[model samples]
Target chain A: MQFWPWYLGGVALTTVAVGHWLLMNRMMAVSGRVTALVNRVRFGPDKAPALSGKELEDALLAATLAAFGDEALKAPPTAPEPAPEPAPSARPQLTLTKPQGPGMHALFFFGLAIGGLLSVLLAGGLEVSPSLRGARFEALFDGPGRYAVLLLGGLCVGFGTRMTGGCTSGHGLCGVSRFQPASLLATAAFFGTGIVTSFAVALLLA
Target chain B: MADPPCPHMKSCEMYEIFTFSETLAVWKTRYCQSDYSRCERYQRALKGQPVPVNLLPNGHLLEK
Candidate 1:
């Protein structure tokens, strides 16, 4: 089966990203969703005076009303644009549009996983193998040891992402596109460390 | 590095209101401090639309 072109994935990513911002006015940070899930489980809602269920929906409605005016309550704008810099004299202020809770994050997480599965299925590449997928992976961690390595690697990734305040999708895609300096720096650090780690792992396994 | 504060904070009316008025400080936290991209005034300005002086960040009209 022919593999999908790399740019198709790029196009999909771009569509999701632009749509995320346009629809939600929020940054599309994949790891942030994980953070939200963990925080929800560990500490409860991020905001004080927590609103849940219908109240949460109402609050969102209120925010939407505030964002788009009275008429917007009827029909919300589809393609929201980033607010521009003020001219000579104007200040920044915003209505607090809270991030979606863990439930939404779980949905997003599942969506990502299911989307990948669907794409693979469509490509006719669905196959089950007990051994780790790559020769390098099998060499590095044979049998059940691969699971341990995967778990440990996942922990490291989670920790690193929380420490950095974002993962590749956040810093690399959204931040870099916005020309945010910190995002640029974070993206560089991520790529730099990733390259070094891959080479080190290869050497060790070899 | 920390996220940069809104560039228009110095001359913005909402900045003054949010700074001096204790109750409105939440606006500062949500938009002025971190992400001004979602600000109504900022967005309006970006689109070359007229932003009224009494317009609040949430797009609500501020009552005098």
Candidate 2:
């Protein structure tokens, strides 16, 4: 079994996490991309915004001024440190529009599949095997039941991803690298659960 | 009566970033303070969407 070394996998993961942000200025969330694809299918195309880039910036500036007055820009220095609690009354009814389309994420999701295929092709010739390719999985889920178990496991992963709003790539790689508290907690939970589950499975199989 | 800050302000990366940059004050003033409902991060958080750390108040990603 030819497996890529851990360091190489780490490097690739870092590049994907950091390069995505460097190039696109957005967090690389594989689950988010999947969600976006699902949303694109469910909701059809998002209402494309009329403005972007400089136009959007200018519009935001204008809206900010209207909402908070001319002093809004300069009032920062005078504003209390640690941010005062906001008064709830009389907020301006304004919403800034943004261009959000799932097209890029859809491509990203497909790109992941292609990347995996390419990696497999480059490492070793692809084999079309109907068997579950792991000894543990074989022991535990030999037969057509394996596919059903795999489906259930995938569903659980998807559900958990949606519930947490992130997954290993998003929270584990990007969030942990950035030292986000939420990410740290999430990653800890992920690893903890994974360890316990694996142990439980091993004991059950034994 | 002072209402609470944006529910996510404590954990929001934008709030942390805005704390240092004088030019970005309008973000804190306009959204983080009272009109947080208008904030894209706030809206996304409300919808149970994954709010990226660099997602700005106006829903654009913070560019380098």
Candidate 3:
């Protein structure tokens, strides 16, 4: 879309997803591999693997760029955090708590539900503009069975997020920015599976 | 070749003055909880592991 807002919003989101991976020294694997990293960091090296500087940069860039919004691109030095405590013992590290079992997970699902509810309510409303067409309060139900689909979409999104350990918002958006190899693979796998499932469902529903 | 630990890792006072605090943060937070997960150094060095299923080049793309 030529819409600047959508493009900008996407960038903002990506930064958030990938930033932690970059920081954590792990590849941004959306394939539920982050748990491995987290275990190592919290428990011991026996649990997870570590990352390299390049990998770190990739992850942070991915998440920070996507989630940091326009502000980060311009003002990165503002928030100088204190140095973190060193690990009690040395081990390869991966995974971060932000993208996993946290409020971020629930927020993603909430956004999906709201999007679906909006779509259903405005199914047949009206179109104001190309970019703003979906923004109208009444046009939520403009499409055929959009409400039902959105509700279903919400469930699908939630399930996918849980299964993948993160959603597009989690892995695709944030995971990639950090240059997480895992995130890259996970995102690819998600897309690949999504495409196959889409075709299957298309034929079934057709 | 065996090298001494990065002098930064030896004592708390020496660690603080090191130029690689940012570098250290990446590895340290990877294995931490609650707040610090941005440290890639900690994750890979202290808390990481190999992927169970190889998803890299040889695994899917260049496989025989």
Best candidate according to lDDT: 2
Q: Tell me the alpha-carbon RMSD of every candidate.
A: 12.6, 7.9, 17.8
**Taking the tens digit of each residue's C-alpha lDDT, what string does model 1 give over A1-206?**
44678999899999999998898777899987776676577656654333334453355445434654555423223323534546534533333334576778878888898988888888888776545466988766677787788788889987888777789899899989989787899989989998998899778888
Chain B structural similarity (TM-score) per candidate: 0.84, 0.84, 0.20
* Model 3, span A1-206: residue lDDT tens: 12335665666445645564576533443334435445546654441223334454454444433443454344224237654657746433432212233344345456556754564455553334323233332244454556666677778866776565566755676566657666688789889988998778556555
Native-structure RMSD, model 3: 17.8
Candidate numbers, best lDDT first, in rank order: 2, 1, 3
- Provide the lDDT at A43 for model 1: 58
Instruction: Give the residue spans of candidate 2 off by over 4 A.
Output: A48-58, A65-100, A128-136, B1-44, B49-64
The DockQ of each candidate is 0.07, 0.17, 0.05
Across residues A1-206, which tens digit of lDDT does each residue of candidate 2 receive?
36678999999988888899898877888887777667667666655444434554455455556556767567665566545444546322222234346667667878898998888788786665545576877866666888788788889988888888789998899889889888899899989998999889878877
Please say which candidate is ahead in lDDT: 1 or 2: 2
lDDT score at residue A199, model 1, on the 0-100 scale: 90
What TM-score does candidate 3 reach?
0.30
Task: State each model's CA lDDT, in order.
Answer: 0.68, 0.71, 0.43
Candidate 1 colliding pairs: A83-B43, A90-B12, A91-B12
